[model samples]
Target chain A: MQGREILFIVLSLVACFAGLGVVLAKHPIKSALSLVVNMFSIAFLYFTLEANMLGITQIMVYVGAIMVLFLFVVMLLNIGSDRSGMKILDLKLVPAILIALLMFSLISFQVLYPLFGMQYPVADEGFGSPEAIGKSLFSQYVLPFEVASVLLLVGIVGAILLARRKA
Target chain B: MLEEFISNLHPVLAIFVRIICFSGIAIMFVPIQVWWERRLLGWMQDRVGPNRVGPFGLLQPVADAIKLFLKEDHVPSGVDKFIYYLAPILAFLPAFALGGTMPWAPAEGLYGLLTPVADINIGVLYVLAISSLGSYGVVLAGYAGNNKYSLLGGLRASAQLISYELAMTVSLAAIILVTGSLRMSEVVSYQTGPLWGIFPYIQNWNLLTPTGLVAGVIFFICAIAETNRAPFDLPEAESELIGGYHTEYSSFKFGLFFLSEYAARFVFSGVFATIFLGGYNMLPVRWDILAVDFPGWSEWFYFMHSANYWLSPVAFIAKCFLGFTVFVWVRATLPRLRYDQLMSIGWKSLLPAAVANFIVVAVWIMVTNLYGMIAGYASLVVSAIILLVLYLNIKAVGFNESTSTKRRIKMAKFNLKENEESN
Candidate 1:
């Protein structure tokens, strides 16, 4: 493999391990942190694909803002050290595991089926450059972008309403 | 020698350059800032600080580092051991990562041999994102500790950060509107010329311009509050909450908390410099002058052509130091605001002000382009009047007097009942 490829492989391995750590770790905060590592690795992958803006945005939005909020909620609730771990597992583990596995299989089937016959389109220029993304976002995806903002606004209103104490 | 090394081993050497540059700044600044703070505090308090540590306390930070390293590390029982350890790393990482985006100085010389670290285009956004992530460490520490005070501190921090985050965002939006870009470098460049006001004869730099000065001042104050600096530092208030969130921490873990605090200060200062002080632009009119007299010098002008290439890091660091000085100065002078006052300031005062500022700046920009003159001074006058009126109203009403009287009466009744029982 080329040096760049080798480096990529190493990073991918680290990312996968970190992701596994996120799931396997007992503490919720640690799991969240591992998820941050996973986000970072994904960001690196984005970087490798020359999606510079996407990579930074991924870190900024997911690893930074979302995860901080997640950590905040986790800390606020103080849910980590309770002896209710076994009880929680007993209540939800079997169903959750089954649903997760079924979902995973469905996704895998869809992905694999697509890969077998469909040829990936090759762009004349690089696929994931900032220019390409910007073009797509402004042109074909403009409606979706505006829609996302509305969705975010709705989410914000819903959150405020939920948090508000009834007078 | 550097050219030879760069040519011989470009890729591997580039990675090394990034690592060295980022780590060097982070590692060196931690100690230097510690010492600077100590000396500054000493000067302020009329006392010699750390004079015994070595050469008028020049080596005091080094001594402190050694002491921290040698100290016994402790982990309290029932704590999430992994997260407890990981929290500090989380705290310190954002500071380092956020430094990636700040354009310290102009790219200098041909081939640009001296960029500090990552010079991404979305530099401002990246810094904001990374700095916001810093809340995680404190939150994680508090949760992992499984202590009530720590949890309270964590909750307060999260709320405080989230609340101020709106004001901060709004403030940044005003700047972005003025600069017409999200890129830190571009923003700095826009501010490098004298801002022409409504009057044709009157022009000044943004710092000197009325609206710009107000925006800069608002941003600076917001930065201080956002960083949880004193007067707004209710999260880790020492007197009330006993060291606040990281109270259970000791040894290197505690050191990490301290490191993150200083590093965040440094990073925010860099941000302030990028946004307000014109990044690595030495003077407001330098670019204009470079274009006019000795136009060839434009090629060699470090602040203009080669910022974010060579001198960017140095300029960035110098700006960061200036920021640190401001933080330290504020810490020395300002008294910590009461918790209720802190909340009111964030929600009622700053939030409204930021929103107003954003609107005014946006309208001003639009109006200036359309009408050839901005009504910014009018907007400023209106905002000032509204603020003054609000302040007066708040002073007039005061706290809930009825509730206070009721509580006092209840306390008296309880004392009388206790006396009767004793008799």
Candidate 2:
């Protein structure tokens, strides 16, 4: 009915399509690219939600840096030729499908029937601006911010060590 | 009807104008730069270059573009076909994306038309982040080609870029210290007025100040290396790796990579202009002079004022082109350094120079603020001393003496095997 709703629907469709492509694409590189597309579409959704910093960071960190690294490792292994020769409808797949279905049903049930009868907060003005995020990050989430950065640094050091060949 | 349409469609038209102006200037400059390089190289080498392609080969780029378009689009078998196709587009996009954040000129009076797509608060940071993304294309091209040469080229390129990036970031931090803002417009504004340091009598402009000049020079060299131009183009060295990362590419895909290189060169030139040269400031004191002369020359200056609006875009383009010419000049003059030499320059020389310059600048800022002395003169003196010390140390160390000897031994080992096989 409204422009914002239409945009949200379009973005959601794009994310769904890209997510499906991530699974369906035979080549690992193509699958990685599909994941990038999915990530980008999710970033668009974040933008529409007015989470500008989060949206940009999602694209910058995940799609730009991390996905490139993913593609790098995939190509280095030369997995392009591994696409063919297998079509299995296994008993193992049934359990995974059942688990996914159970999870989705549980999530839907929780959403529809709130045990505490509490409602989600409505979107407020300045909900996702830089000022709002900055205030919240510094004031409310200061420990988490510092902890996350430390964890990131550790991961970066670990990655460098793993990637470096034995001298 | 026309006036109403123009008024109603102003915002959309402004976006269109930017798209046209930026892309048109970039596209036009690419050919001009190519021709300029060929002619310059020709003059340097004592030979005529492309004389038959129309009037000293002025039309040569057009001819070359046509040829490239008509050429067969060859896809190498056993390559990652999708990624190989995507590589050039990825390579090209970041170069274009970087242009959006660069403030080409100062805002117009009253009407307030500003140059650049958007004056994002984090302009410098945005440019750095986008430029860093360029490594992805090179890395992807290398891996996707499924060629050993390509893979090695990509790995080397990524490593080189990552190494230089640290020095580049440190150099930028020095600029940020002086400017005190990440925004380009603020940085340019800070450069205005009689040159004085944060303390009394300190020179303001980064180019004029000692630490700023060193940082600027370091930043310039790092930019050149980052773009993989001559003296740092080991990723595509014909002598060693054949064709480097894009060896398997053909037709328009290859063209995209080629275009992106020139685009990147242009973008860096604009960046240097914005940072060191003072973007959109015509004369050093043009803003000051104009403010004083505005009322007196109101009638004539009105025409000049309207003309100034148009001139902002022209000034930006002229600055960018001047930057490109300098890049071309360096490419013509310098011989390619060996890969080891390139790494050593980045790691041993530039990195240390940048770090030392940053420390000197930081100290200068602090001491001047504390003692309340003549900050500009002190900063200049301190920076000069640091630079002299760095140069003396570099000279005394003898950059490549031991490394060249080791390389010679390695080459000798290869030669001995060849001789044994032949015998």
Candidate 3:
């Protein structure tokens, strides 16, 4: 394999482990931190894909902003580790594991299906540029983008309403 | 020799050399900055500061570093050992890494041999992302310290950072709109154009333009808050939190926190210099434009232009130092803001001003493209007036009466409690 492919493989491995760390970590803060690592690794994966804009946005939004708020809340609440030591074979674990496996398999199949024999298509010039992304969003996917933004605004308003104290 | 040495190396090796060289230079400035800030602050406060360590205390940071190195490292009990160890390194890395996207010189000729290690397209966003990462160091440090003061400091740092990030981003958005490129180099080059797109004799640094002035002011304020400098430094208010996030740290670890703060200050200054202060140009005059306009003095103008261009890295460094001086100046001038005041300034004032500037710049650009310059200016004036009127109305209706009523009720309740106590 080329160096790029090898590098991608290494990054993806790191990302997978970090994802596991996020779910498996006992302490809430540790879990949040693992999720940050996972996000950063995924951002690197995006960088490797040559989606520079997407990679930076992922870091800026998820790791930089959202995970920070997660950390803040976790820290503020002073939560501790779960020491219940629930058995792996618990009834709740069986269905959770089964559903997780099913979803993983489905996602892998969909992803790997495209790369079975065909080579990846070459990216167009400036394909991952801000201008290109902006143009495409405005011209082609404008409706979805606008709708998503409106949905976010609604979510924000709803959150404010829920959090507001009554007189 | 430097150029030949750089060019002769393998591409990957060359990049490494550049990264090391640039980072070393930036890191070296930290001690100098420390010394300068001390002397400057001392001067401002009418006292001699650190003058006994070295000549004008030039070697004070060196002495400080030595002391920190020799001092025994201490780990307080009940601390999160791993995170406690990790925090300082975390703080230091992002601050140093902030230099990665900074263009010390234009990517041309002699000066371009070794600087701006990354030079990626999304330079501004990269800065924002990395800067946001910086808060992790402070936040994590606070958490790991296992102290209530540390936790409060960490919480405050996180909230402050997130709030200011919005204002900083929106303020920079105006510049991005004006430049139409996310690349740092492009932003610099755009500034090299004719002043105000009218005067051919002067360079159009962002700070000189109307919308740019507003954005620059807001961005600078946010940068100050982002670095936790005085006035906005509620997170680490020593009087309240006893060194805040680093209260539990001592020895080299504490030194690391100190180094990172100064380093971040230096680099953030460099960024402000690049964005608003016209990158590396010696002065705001366009020698090239003069060279074209007046052929009789063309040789002299060309000479001046070349001097400005080739010595750009030096100019960039000087600008960064100057910006650092301004940072120190600001610290000396302003008092530490109260926590509520800090939050309100970040959210209510800076954010709104930045957003308004962004909208005005966007409108200006759109109008300029559609009609002409005059029409664009007209639209700018009209839109600004409308925004001002709307802002006043919103303030009058939403804030003035309700706040007054709330204050009155609160005062009456306080009085009633006082009377009850007397009885």
Candidate 4:
């Protein structure tokens, strides 16, 4: 395999392990930190895909801002490691296992089916430039972009309303 | 032979050499900054600074480093061992990496060999992203120490960083709009243009323009807060939090924190210098323009212009040092702000002002693009007048409402007294 492919494989493995760490870690802070690792590895994956702008945005928005908030809340609450009294054979485990299997099968099918005759197109030189992204965002995808912005605005207003005092 | 060796070096080795040089110079500045701050602070407060050590205490930091290394590296009982070990590294790394995108000199010719380790397209945002990561170190340090004061310091740091980052990014967004690019080199080159696109004899430093001046001031304040310097140094407020996040840290870990803090200050000062103070140009004067405008002194002007071009690294370092001095001056001049005051400054004052400046820049750019320069100026004046009038009207209404409410409260009190008497 080429060096780039090797690098990609390594990054993907790291990302997968970090994702597992996020789920399996007992402490909430550990899980949050694992999620940060997962996010950073995914950003590197984006870099490998040559989507530089998207990769940067992923790091800046998710790992930098959102995960920081997750850590902030976790640290502020001072939560301890999970030590619940529930037994291993709880009824809830069955449904959770079923759902997990369902998700795994669905994702695997989509991945396996795509491997048969997939062909990827080469991206142009300016494919991931900020100017290119801006142009497409404002011109071609303006409607969806505006809708997403409005949704964010609604989210902000809702948050403020929920946090406001009764008076 | 040396030139040939450098030019023909492998790409990977070249990058390694460049990074080593960049980091070596940056780390070297920390000791000097430490000495400068102590001497300056002492002078300001009327006392002798570190004069007993080697030659005006120039070697004090080296002595301190040795002392810290020799001290016992103690860990408090009941602390999270993993994160406690990780915290100082996290704090130190991001601060060093923040300097990655800062251009020391023009990215051409011989001077381009060692500065700006990474000249990425998203330079400004990269800075923001890295600086945001710095708070994690403080927050994690606070949490891992398992001390009340450390936890409080961590909480404060996270909140403070989040609040100030908004204003910082917004103010920088105004500058981005003006420069029309996010690359650090582009931002610096934009400043090297004619002052306000009119004055040809002077370089267009961002501090000289109206909107740029406001944005620069806001960015400077936010940089101070981001670095956790005084008066915004709440995270490690010694009197209050007892060294804050590093309270339980000792020996080398604490020394790491100290090194990171000074390095961050030096880097942030360099960033400020690059963004606002005409990165590496010796003066705000365009010597080339002088050469063109004056034929009699053209030979002397040409010589000076070439000197300015070649000696840019010195100029850049000088600017960074000047900016560092200002940081110290402000630290000495201002008192630690109360928590509420700090929050209010970030949210109410800096954020709003930055947003207003952003809008002004946007409007100016749009108007200038559509109409000509004269029309842009006219639109600016008209908009300013309209905004002023709107502000006055709002103030008047608020004043009337407040007075009426007060009078009503007085009347209600009087009525209650009369009712009691009748009963």
For candidate 2, the docking band is: acceptable
Ranking by lDDT: 3, 4, 2, 1
Q: Please state the CAPRI-style docking class of candidate 3.
A: high
lDDT of 3 by residue, A1-167 (tens): 98789989998898899888887887888888889988998999998888999999999999999999999988987878876754666798889988999998998799867668977788987868788888999999999999999999999899789967886
Tens-digit lDDT string for candidate 3 (B1-423): 878878899888988987887778878888999899999999999999998886888899899899988888988999878889999998999988887878888788655767778788899999999999999999999999999999999999999999999999999999999998899989998999998889989999999999999999999999899888888888788999998999999999999999899889889988998999999888999998899999999999999999998888889999999989999999999999888898889889899999999999999999999999989989999999999998899889878889999999999999999999999
The residue pairs in collision within model 3 are none
User: Candidate 3, after superposition: displacement of residue A4 in Å?
Assistant: 0.8
Candidate 1 deviant stretches above 4 angstroms: A2-25, A48-51, A81-110, A116-154, A164-167, B197-206, B287-316, B373-423
Model 4 spans > 4 angstroms off: A85-110, A113-121, A164-167, B1-3, B384-423
Give the Cα lDDT of each candidate.
Answer: 0.73, 0.76, 0.90, 0.88
Q: Which candidate leads the pack in lDDT?
A: 3
Expressed as tens digits, the lDDT of each residue in B150-242 for candidate 4 is: 999998998899899999999999999999888899999899889978889899999998888989999999999999999999999999999
Look at candidate 4 and tell me the lDDT of residue A24. Answer: 76
The lDDT of model 1 is: 0.73
Per-candidate interface DockQ score: 0.50, 0.26, 0.83, 0.66
Better of 2 and 3 by lDDT: 3
What lDDT does candidate 1 reach at residue A44? 87
B140-162 in candidate 2: lDDT tens per residue? Answer: 89888889999878877777777
- Cα deviation of B22 in candidate 4 (Å)? 1.5
